[model samples]
Target: MKTAKILKVATFFSWFACIGLTIKSGAILVTYLLSISNPEASKNMYESLNLFEYYNHSFLNYSIIVFYKIVLFSVEAYIAYLVIQLLKKLNIKQPFNIDVHSLMRKISFAIFYLWIIAIVHNTHIQIIGKKHNFELSLFSSDFVFLSLVIFIFAQIVKRGIEIQSENDLTI
Candidate 1:
């Protein structure tokens, strides 16, 4: 009983994390769109958008970039943890139920779509000189591929859970 309750709570957290990911993903998409729509305007806006000067040293800019990367990485890591919990909830020992499978498929599809969008956005930044030289296209591609694989695995697990549920119901 306690484990069930814990699983439920974890699922809720996963949903919450998904929401945050969606918001952050949307922000990145919007920024990318804006940049593409008006490159000159985007450049001007970025140049004028000064959050902090930090005693006239340029190191602050790099620090801020590092901080943003750290936060983004942390969010991604949390989402991955939540995804694992969700997969555990599927209890993939049995298969035949449709509900769990369907839900998992939808989530997987959404995540894949989001991954594609992120890759596109990142690529756009790299092309536009907004990203650093260290940024590689392969990195974005790998992230998208990994996300797709994880989501697909989740869907497979959910399908198993559904089948189990159906067997239980029939018996």
Candidate 2:
């Protein structure tokens, strides 16, 4: 009973995260478009990032960085959506199911993809800032460690599913 309740709460939070991230990504994209028309808009880009200098530096670099950010956020939102689906399909009484296993794998892959993008994005920022003498910085996340943990958990779940199937066949 407690586990089910916890799962319900987790599902709610995951849905909330998915919606919030989607909104954030859309707002960033809209800000980028607005900045194109009004350069002043770049001064207070999404969450007050203030990429005006980058905008002035090189339009291509500005667009690429913003696009990478959008992709990162979108991937995060997708991961949250996948969690919600997994939670919804989960059965407390019979927890080992193919859908759950597959969803776990999908989530792990999405997280891994996000990690890769983040690395590239950060590297791009560092190289650009260094080469151009700009002191720009983007917050780095420990996504590689996180993705590995989730991937390991997914593998454990896969093993559980296999064991459960074998047990059921014997009965």
lDDT of 2 by residue, 4-73 (tens): 8999999999999999999989998999999998988888877777888889999999999999989999
Query: Which ten-residue region of model 1 has the weakest summed lDDT?
Result: 47-56
After superposing candidate 2 on the true structure, give the runs of residues whose Cα lies further than 4 Å from its correct spot. none
RMSD values for the candidates in order, in angstroms, are 9.5, 1.2
Error of 1 at 81 (Å): 16
Best by TM-score: 2
* Model 1 lDDT tens row, 32-116: 3464444433232232422122112333443333234334444464555546544564653433345445555555655565566
Query: What is candidate 1's CA lDDT for residue 124?
Result: 46
Query: How good is model 1 by TM-score?
Result: 0.44
Give residue 16's error in model 2 in angstroms.
1.1
- In model 1, what are the clashing residue pairs, if there are any? 94-160, 94-164, 95-160, 95-163, 95-164, 96-162, 96-163, 97-162, 97-163
**Residue 114 lDDT (model 1):** 50
